[model samples]
Target chain A: MADKIFRVNMADLTTSIEDIPADWAGHGGRGLTSTIVSAEVEPTCHPLGQNNKLVFAPGLLSGTAAANSGRLSIGAKSPLTGTIKESNSGGTAAQLFAKAGCKALIVEGLPKADNWYSLALTPDGVTITEEKELIGQGNFAVVQALENRIEGKHGLLSIGQAGEMRLASANISIKDPDGSLRSCGRGGLGAVMGAKKIKFITVDPKDGKVAIAKPDAFKDANRIFAKALVDHPVSQALGQYGTNVLTNIINESGGFPTQNFTKGQFEGHESISGETMHDTIKERGGKVKHGCHQGCVIQCSQIYNDADGKKLTAGFEYESIWAMGADCCVDNLDHIAEADRIMDDIGIDTIETSVAMGVAMEAGVLPFGDGAGICKLLTEDITKGTGIGRIIGNGAGSVGRAFGITRVPVVKNQAIPAYDPRAIKGIGITYATSTQGADHTMGYTIATNILNVGGKVDPLTKEGQVELSRNLQIATAAIDSTGMCLFIAFAALDDEKCLPALVDLLNARFDLSLTGDDVVSLGQHILKTERAFNTAAGFTSADDRLPEFFYNEPLPPHNVVFDFSGEEIDTFWDF
Target chain B: MKISVKLFAYFRDNRFKIKEYDIDEGTTVGNIVDDLNIDREEVGVLMINSRHTNFDVHPVEKDILAIFPVIGGG
Candidate 1:
């Protein structure tokens, strides 16, 4: 297969092709997107403005038959967090993209008219076609329409009404192999696409393959990587119970982030626990341990169905459950599932919406634990983009601002995920300082603090957690760039061969001579690039700091406050 | 001595989610896991009085010992 670049100038609605530049040859997925944005885009430009460009690239091994290598990265200036952002997902689009011999797709400039368009990538080139029919449709309806229009097997990436209205927390939804959708869910990249007036991008490759430099070496490495994933207990657990398994564990640990961060434990946790969900799925004849994309041996995703055996949602992840359930005090899993479906259809970040729901409830907009109320809010209010709906769609930070509430648990204006910072103090440090706002995958010190996979870092010990978080963040940045699922970290931390196997895979694919040290350097370079961009965009250490409320209000279980001083948080930038 | 024990994730399988038992105050957290037939290797995090500790850590009066299997997500 051949490899080239597809650049779309949205200003004039023109498309062009260029050779894959030598400098960008080593990078892919998050790496390439960050590099390109740093080099080409203005850091200080308004995220919804013409100067901001949205870039999409497949992972390093995406097009190939590498296990768990189908995650696609979309990067741009975040309207939600005002930071350089890279959001990822697993879907059919990445594989088709890689197979088409396309290295990266960059959409730049802005359309003069307020018209929507869609791009189709075929064997020869990309075509920018204007579309009026698909403008206001939900993601599911849009995908069905696209499939009907194309009349063949293809991959899709489309946004919903939230994106069309340019909400700050809108996400880009990617079509999975099963015609279900997975999302690049964070940082409002969908709004960036909306600003460009692109409705969706379709990839229907006639025939193409990944350009492999050493197929034999890649195959050998693949065998090792695949085995490592299959042989891991964590992977097995994820396959069986899925990520929602954390409900009981985190609740038992007394760090569940209940009722909008007011408490750490949920009394109704058992109702929405993974074990309960697993039993319900089995009774309802839903498929469990399903892969969202090809070559995923772990299969942590699942298809959740209603009592009538009708599909409700796929890949009902832990963060979504936690945000929609415990954080909002909604114990009804079915209601949460419906909320998930609506969020998927509307193209909004679930974590942000969950936090916004909590804020809305706290502001007397709706009572907490009102499942029906939440469903109505999501369907009738948020989906239609009403006045108050606009605030919720914008994200937790905006909801808090609208209601004048101070307890919003957000960093860089992005809502924090499941874990409670006060319970795990290291997470507080991470939430306060991560380059991408309150993101756990950025560093995920939980591997050591909770799982004890890498090494023991006492969760309550400030010094150790800081050092542990720093090292993990560096390693994580590198892993995210490779298009590998972050779950590989469990195997990588335990089995010494895991990281080497991944490096070997990359080296074989690209014919590059890279060492373990190079990976570390690459991670550092990427973080530094992002940090520099945020700095130039007028972000200060003050923006990096968590709100003052976390310091004053001690969370239960540990009853520990977020005591990390400004100095400790600033140390995260030392690299 | 009265002490409380909480198990998390897969450890809850065939085990109570939270149970209280009367035992010697000097009992090690390792003894409790072993007594419950939980493999030391299977136990990921050990918290004594809500602080991180190892298997060798001995409990004091009213100490809440929480045992978590390798529960990893997000």
Candidate 2:
């Protein structure tokens, strides 16, 4: 069966499988979600209201035997950033959705009844059922309970207490192969799901398979693609240390965003460094390397354990460590791990919530370096939905507004991640011009600016920053569409065999003659479509800017402020 | 001349995390990497006093030099 658009109306409790629209036939993942939202969703609709539709899509190569193609893109009007949002994650859901012949799943309209529901999708269609037992539970409990409640192997996506409270920092948690959670961890799409009163959505392919137009050609391309990914030195490093390897590298670059973006380096960076984390994990008998999805060649995820060797968290990423560790001045790895586990269970974006905590700390709600205090706040406040918890749960911008702090680090109301853009000017442009707000993954200029992967661009200079960000943002949009892991870009940029093999994978799967230029065109089209939606939604160039502090308070060590004039930043859109 | 050296990731596997080194005044970053038995290609980033530098650059006294393997992640 050709993949179909699955639509569920919460207001009327109706489900329908519609034929794939002609315009959407070639699109997948972020491209499809953005295209669908632009076509169907009203630009001015309240993000958490009935008019905002939530769309889930697997990439074009997803569910195929392609390496690193198991990413699922979830899109909606963000209650957090208030821009058209697409946050993707790794889990079984993408592969399952693709195998089930679901090109995209669209959930729209508000539920009139004041009750929670769940959607169960099979190869046949979707069924809506009333959910009662696990309504207010955290994501961990929900997954455990569903494991017994549902029979057979299935994929789940759920939201927890934060989502139930409709917090702006809430994220949709997707179940990994081991039943642990991986989050679509930005832009508060979970609040959209919660507003529609969905507790979880499960996908069971039931032996269904994604059809390929040229199987032999696809197998050959996938072989070359996987080799390119595996042969890269960066991939080897990521497999060894996970993404946390960047902690020390970024810290050394003096762009680690320490202590609420006030400084660039942390005095206690050694304790929470990836090197320390790796040795600690080895000592505690935790798995040093793990994959979130089945086809992942680069297993950047890991199972971190507490002192007693009990599992504390998995998929402990650099951004989360930076937010909770350096950005908050918490030195202890175990404390950061505990808080990480809590955030995962709560189904909240760790970057948003922890950065919010940093702002709250600056407001004197708690002293800095209080890791236990951070855990206490998450448990007793955020999870319980206390008034102060709501302030933090709404994200860094909300916390800043509540405390009257002028040095808050947010762009378009979304908290900036680990990088301090004042030192690395390329990323600063990306943070400013990104349609999804201050997201590192949207462009990831760090690869070239700091790591020298694609090529060297002077990090401290403003000369080539705008052009670099524009090119990266465009490529990233296209990469996100294929559902390939963003890490593939390291090899794609440097390895001669990488990108062509990727394009070959797409061509072989769909039987289309897409050249490299076609891929670039796809990327540009996706960005323009997303930008057009944000434009229609009342965003001006002024919205595409970093906070004033980035330009005023020069970061330490470098003693440099983000000096890009608005005109320089506006040039990012020239492409 | 006295300088501090900070090594991270696999560079610290058989070596110290941060150590103080006393060297000749004109010692470049390459000289230190050679002394530490670290391959030039293996060095992903070299920072002197928290700023990006290369193997050819001479570090001043009291500089804090950090070395990392060819690692990249977001």
Candidate 3:
């Protein structure tokens, strides 16, 4: 078995070699990262300090042409949320890492100085090179520099000035096939990389092709999985409209956080919804349905263009649209597209940055719907480190604090994602209780068959949300470890056969026997571990809650307030 | 009888861009959706006169209808 571990210590510039435990071979990717992070990192320590380690791993099915399986996860204690965080991204890195014959790469400790550097990995070993010249460069430029140095095709993960400044909203940008930037953009993990003084990582495929443990079984399983993804209605919608498909649904549900959550529905939501984006791209002849990673059957990304048909940004997904469009009250798609480009280039978490801008607007820094002004602030002042831009880059909670805004929507310092908890009660429960604050992916409720694990209740009822959230969190934890994209859960929920097929694939790949029940157990274990860590870190049950405004001011359209009491919310994890 | 209908997301691009439809009086949101040649399964939630409505809810003149997709987590 080709099992190896690569460890880099920034404090002393030391590299060590280790062997992976035999049990870990089956885990791979996200599973490995979660395990390692939980075992090694101290939960309550300063996230940017030497106590936290950043772990990168590819999925169990990655590197073998498993459609949509080329995902890499970065796990760390979040500087922004003060909780466990794992952000997954699609690019060439995971495939390259798998090909290099290493299951995981762990970067531990912190550099002693403010110097900038990049890590270059080859078949031989890892090399740290001075990249001071590339300091302060945006994500696009940083990727270009690394690409030129590596020769031919190379996978990269780099940060922009926002990370360099240790901004909580920073993101780690991964180079896409077209030289555009995609990111593992949440939980402020980029700041952790920045704290390590590492500017970028270049993974060259010169390491060779990845070898699958069971090629025949992998191929069979992947074929079935790929077909399922292609046939699913959710996949079809995503392929057609990209992520902006949620705009109308969220608005209709009265959960599209508008004007800084002062309102729920955006009046001009249709103009910026996924359908509008698709039409605009078609009329301009721009490319739609771009893939984030190789061999992805459901290409739910897009290359948005301006009126002149010039490319503005790639993969302007739903979270970015809600944060910039509905949250900020901007209806114009072009403006939202431009803002997306700015966030990508600047290496900022689009969700956090957009929410920060909304909060800033609420503070009267700029009027809501001032899309042009927001763009200028991000592109010009933020890069230049101006006064307002500095606070905006700091993230939503910080910006809210700096401006004395009380209505900021956040939990544990992390700005909430696109979903409004009041309308989608189950999702709100997830957001409130997730180890990572206000994160949607921690327990996605929208498009999953959650087994009715929590007794069935009306979608509009608050009765079973806490239980549903708990079940989803456990299931999500298990899925994350396999390095499978959480999107797969959509099929897994609806297709009773899908989970068993996935288990079979895992068993064949690792040459071990496992069942669907084992997957559930594994997921539960991960959630329990994360919860223990958070508890040890001093987070109490009270910390898991929505903002008071959610309780007092009912959201529009539905007019449903966040009604779950703290005691009821705490009952979620009783199982 | 005329009803103001706004198609959001993919529905707008696919079938509702060119012109607004005026259906017979007492027509339901379901009927208008059927008349527009839009697949009912693809539409997730239906709103009539700014209130949440089931697919079976009938429509009236001057009533505004909004339809959206079911799959929405990002």
Candidate 4:
């Protein structure tokens, strides 16, 4: 069966299934979602309004026995950044979504009533149910209730009170195979979902019965791909240490973005470093090197445990550690872990909220390095929707505006992640020009600039940074559309055979003739569609810029500022 | 002369996270890494007193030198 698009319009509670448009057959994941949003939705409409749409799409190779190819991309006109957002994640939902033969699932329009609803997808069709019983619960409870409540073996995607309240930093939580939650956690698409009154989404596992076009060819390509992934030293290290391995290294490199971007290094960074976190996790009998989703070879995710050896969090990332630990000046690893768990349960983007905490700290709403106080702010104040909580929940930009804080590290109203752009010039271009706001995943130049995964580019120099960022952004857009985990890039960049193998996998899956150049075209096409949409939404080249403070404030360690001019950053769009 | 040396990420797996190293005042970062037995090819980034430095950079007295292996997540 040809994959079909399932459209749900909340205005009158209607649904329609349509065949995949010929033009859209080649696109999936970010490419598909961005294409649909750019073509179907009004770009200038308010993000949470009826005219805006939220789209979920599995990658082209999803659910087809492709290793590490279970990524799901969620696209929308972002409530947080007010730009085009394509936030992707690894979880069971993408596999199931594709297995059910869905090219894309689009949620459009606003519900007429104030009540909430839920949708369950079976191989046969989609069923919408009015569910008020589980409205205010967190993601953990939502996933738990659905098993007994809905009677199905399926993957779950849900939101928490943060989403229900339409917080700008809200994210949609997806249940992993182990019943732990992962997130499509950027750009506030959760707010759009909430505005449409979707409490949760479940796709039944039996619905997935996908067949690869050329089984033997796919098998051979996948074998080569998996070998490349596991053989790479970086992939092996990630499988062992998880992403938190970056904490100490980034901090030591003098680009950790500490204390709301006041400095690049944190005095208390060592306390929350990956080494310390790993030691504590080991002592607590926690499992490291776990995968957030099934079929992932490089398992950078871990199941962090508390003192009692109980589950604390999964997928505890380096950026979150930086945002909650160093950026906010709270270094107690346990406190940071608890905060990470809470952020997950509450369905907020960890990076945005952590940066919001930094903004709040700068406002004197909460003091920096106050571990207990930060927890209280999240649990007591933010959860209950107090005035301060609401402001912070609105995201870093709102918090900075409310408090008159000028040093906020945000571009296009979305907070930057762990890396200090002033210290690493290449990422500055990415943060400045990314259509999704200050998003690192949009163009992870760190691979080349810092990690030397692709090629070495001087982190402190302006030369090659723009070119590096542009190439990475294009490559990333293509990767996000492929349904494979981004970590594959570590292998693909280093081993020349890795990318061709991935292309072969896709070609085998679809029975087509695709080359490395075709992959590049796919990437370039997605970026162009997204940029055109952003431009239609009133994003001038002027909007593609870092914050003024990034230019004025010199981060210590390097004492360097984001020195790229508007003309230089604008060159990213020349593609 | 003594310079404060820090090891980051896997560089500290079996080694020290940080320590006071007794090196000559003009000792280069490459010399210190060699003394610590960290592979030169394995080092991704290097810094001195919070500023980015290369292996050829010789630390002054009281300098805080840090060595990091390749690491990227975000």
Candidate 5:
């Protein structure tokens, strides 16, 4: 392994390479990113301050051709929620970083100039280029410009105007195949990038291949994992239907957030469901499923098309559907598709943008289902940075506050995802206490063997939710550190051998023998470390909770309220 | 009494579309599972009146039941 760290100091436009920590070899990717951010960056520093650092690391199995293993984690203190944040994305960047023979990239210090610039990493070294010409360009345009300029095949991570303005809901876009925009679109990390005066980071690996320490064992483990994923029903559904498959299921369960979360079920879920998307793709002759990266076997991503069979977007996942569909009271799939394309181009968080629009409609700023009005508001008015556009850019919490809507569904200033916690109480717990606020990936309980951490509790029962959330959070932290996609949890839960096999593969590759228990312990430790950072940053148990509206309003279909007591919720992490 | 048994998604596509099963008084969800010839392990979420319920939970008369396979992802 190359024992080197690539460091970029924007203050002096200086770059250097240093030896990697001897202990960091086994802990590449998310493990390395989280550890470096937590240790090196001050927990209490302003998210956009010079004291903050953005660290990117690929996973332990990132370089190897492990299925769905090419994941890159961008970790720093989040501007949106003011918490420790790590957002993992899949594209070509992780694989490129691995091939570049570097474990991680640490971007430190704010730029001395007030102009836009970008850092390009290649086999030769790093170059700082003036990106002022690239300013005001959308994510796709910026990506194309960077690709053209870099003179080879490259992966570009760039932010749009939302990030430039330091909008709390800003996201960083990564290029997918056929040049569609996929993003790390949660937790305002793009604002942090904006603060650094860095418009984009382009990584190219002209070097032939990423060396693997144990190729045979890695291949065997990867094959087993691939087979398990292919055989799993959830994986099959995801591959076939994309994430929109959950639209009907969540609506049926009364957990699909609708009309700014005033109701749990949307009356028109079928119009925007996975089935509809699948049919649309078929009719339009679009690709139903494709990989986000080269070696991904799950292939849950899809190339969405217009009614006329023209390409509209790629990777139109469930959250985007929920945001534009039920949440905003727009059931027109084509309108939702257009909104998704706009979000991708603008480099913004779809969930936050949808929730903000919902709140705006509630405030009578625009009528519900006003897709054209929303399009104008986001694309045309937002660049002016005045009037309602400013409030919309601030995220769901800020918009809710501006509109005096107490029913705003958020935790730590970040809007909640598609799952309404009242209906799916297990996921609610995860949203409240997650290191990154209100995130579903923090603790995915979809297919896990419901660990009897609390008891056999009903989804509507509030009694055991805290403990459930806590347990899942710990498990998810460990999973994220592996640099593995959280979707693996579906197969890993039922196939008990998968987790052990993963650990075994890591151990063999890193020359260590780690037991399954040790893996669990590592997860716990990562959470504890994150929690300590949050605590020191002035987060109390009170901060670990869903918004107040959830406690009073009863969600539909089941009509259950979030009934967990404050004490029970507070005591959740005692374990 | 008879209750309607409906399977969705892969189950509907793969197995019998829909069927009416003659059930006894005080019949529970577990009994329905046994009667349908579906693997109990395959059922991840069971709903009656649009609320999630476990296998051991008893079904009420005239209850509209929907069974979903253990399918979930983000």
Candidate 6:
């Protein structure tokens, strides 16, 4: 069967399989999701209203033997940012959707009644059934219950209480290969899904295979690509320490946001560093390196354990640690891990929620460094949808509005992640100008600014930072479309063979003669298309900026502020 | 000159995390790395007094030097 689009209408509980549209044929993952959302969703519609549509797309190379090509893209008009948003995650869903011959899954129209539903996808088509048992459950419970309800191995996407409450920080959780959860943890897409009345969706691809136009060539390209990935030093470090490796390095660079962005470095950084996490994991009988999806050569994820030697969180990442640790001034790794587990179960974006905690702490909701208090709020308030919980769950911008806190570090309503933009000027441009809001993944200038993977840009300076952000954002758009993990970028920037081998894999899979320049064009086109959608949605260049605090306050240690003028930031769109 | 040196990630393997070194005047950052038996190629980031620096530069007294292996993640 040729790849087809699966449409599910909650209004009437109808399902249909349609031919892949010609215009969307060349796009996949973020490209396809953004294109579909741009074309189908009304820009001015309330994100949780009937007019908003949610899209799920596998990357062009997904479901194949290509390494690190299992990321799934989920797009919608964001309830948090009110911009066109695409958040991708690592899981089996993308590969399963591709294997089931599904190019994309579009869910639209809210049900008139309050009944929730679940959609099951197969090679034939989608089947929508009224869902009741898992409606109010957290993601872990839902995944656990479905294991007995479903017959065989299946790919799952579900939301938790936060989603059910329609909080802006709600995230759609994807089931990993090991039954742990990976998340489309940005832009409040989970709330959109919850608003559409979907508790969960299951995908089962039985004896299905993705077709490769040139099998031999594809094999050769994948070998080269995977080799380049595993051979890179950054990849090696990630495997050993997981993404938490950045705690010490970023803290050392004096770009680590601490105590709600008031300081550039954390005093207790050593206690929460990746090295400490790694040692703790080893001592607690946990795996230091684990892959979130199949065929991922750069396994940056890990299984974190508590002092009792039991699993606390899987796929423990740096952003989550930094958000709950340095940002909120909590240094206990176990507390952060427990909070991470709760956020995963609650189906909330950790970055958004923890950053919200930071803002709430600034508001005296709880004192800073209160790890247990943060967890208590996550369980008692946010999960139960209390008034205070809603404020924090709605995200950093919402908390700032609710409490009149001025130092809320957000761009376009989305919480800024681990990197402090004040000390790192290139990332500041990315935070200001990103179409989907303040997402580090939209363009990780850290590679150049801090890590020196691509090259040095002197992160503290304004020179060449705008052009650096523009080029990276363009390249990131293309990469996000390919279903490859963004970690491939470290190798892509430094290794000469990496990007070419990736292009070769795409060419071999699609039987096309695409050059590197064509990849660049695809990236540029995706960015422009998404930008046009945001523009139609009433976003102007004025929206492309950081919070005033970033410009006004000088972070300590370095004592540098994000000094880029509005005109300098506006130049990011000159490309 | 008393220079405080901090090592992170794998650079701390079989070595101390932080130590104060009273070194001869005009000693470069590379001398500290070589004295500590850390490979130059394995160093991802090198900084002194919270400023990114190269190995060739000489360190002043009371300078805090931080060394890390190549590490990248979002």
Q: Candidate 5, A174: how far from true, in Å?
A: 1.3
* TM-score (C-alpha) between model 5 and the true structure: 0.93
Ten-residue segment with the worst summed lDDT in candidate 1 chain A? Answer: A456-465
TM-score of chain A of each: 0.99, 1.00, 0.96, 0.99, 0.96, 0.99
Off by over 4 Å in 1: B1-4, B20-26, B59-64
Question: On residues A324-432, what C-alpha lDDT tens digit does candidate 6 reach at each position?
Answer: 9999999998899999999999999999999999999999999999999999999999999999999999999999999988988999999999999988889989999
- Candidate lDDT scores, in order, read 0.87, 0.93, 0.80, 0.87, 0.79, 0.94
Model 2 error, position A573 (Å)? 0.9
lDDT of 3 by residue, A1-575 (tens): 36477888998888776888776655666567777888899887998899999998887766767677778888888888888878888877877877776678899988887677788776555777777878888888887776676668888899888888788888898887788888999988788999999989988757477666677987788778777767766777788888788787667656678899877789998799887888899899888888888887778889888999899899889999999998999998899999899888888999999999999998888899999988999988787778888789888998888988888899888899887887778888888888778888888774432112122334467876777678788888877766667777777766666677777677767776888788888877777777787887889998999888889888777778888889888887886
Could you give candidate 2's per-residue lDDT for residues A259-330 as a string of tens digits? 899999899887887888888999999989999999999999999999999999999999999999998999
Question: Which candidate number has the best TM-score?
Answer: 6
- State the lDDT of candidate 4 residue by residue for A286-389, as single tens digits: 98778877789888888889999998988898888889999999978889989999988889999999899998899898799998887888898778888988
Itemize residue pairs with steric clashes in candidate 6.
none
How well does candidate 4 score on lDDT at residue A305? 96
Which segments of model 2 are wrong by more than 4 Å?
A: none
Candidate 5, position A156, lDDT:
80
Scored against the true structure, residue A550 in model 2 reaches a CA lDDT of: 90
Candidate 3 per-residue C-alpha lDDT over B9-59 given as tens digits, one digit per residue, 9 for 90 to 100 = 566655664345677766777887788788887776666654567667777
Candidate 4, residue A483: CA error in Å? Answer: 0.8
For candidate 5, what is the lDDT? Answer: 0.79
For candidate 3, give the lDDT of residue A339.
87
For lDDT, candidate 5 versus 6, the one ahead is 6
Tens digits of per-residue lDDT, candidate 5, A1-575, equal 46368888988888888888776655666567778887898888999889999888877777677777777888888998998888888888887877777678888999877888988887556788877788887787897776677676887889988888888888988776567777888888888899988899988877646666677877787778788777777788788888777787778778888998888889888789887788799899889998888877778899889989899888999998998889889988888888888888888999888888888888888998887778788888665567678789888888888988787778999889998888888887788778778988887643332221123456666665666667767777777777677777777766766777787668656667888888778778778777888888889888988888888888887788877777777676785
Of the true interface contacts, the fraction found in model 6 is 0.89
DockQ of 3: 0.37
Clashing pairs in 5: A29-A58
lDDT of 2 at A20: 95
Model 5: TM-score, first chain = 0.96
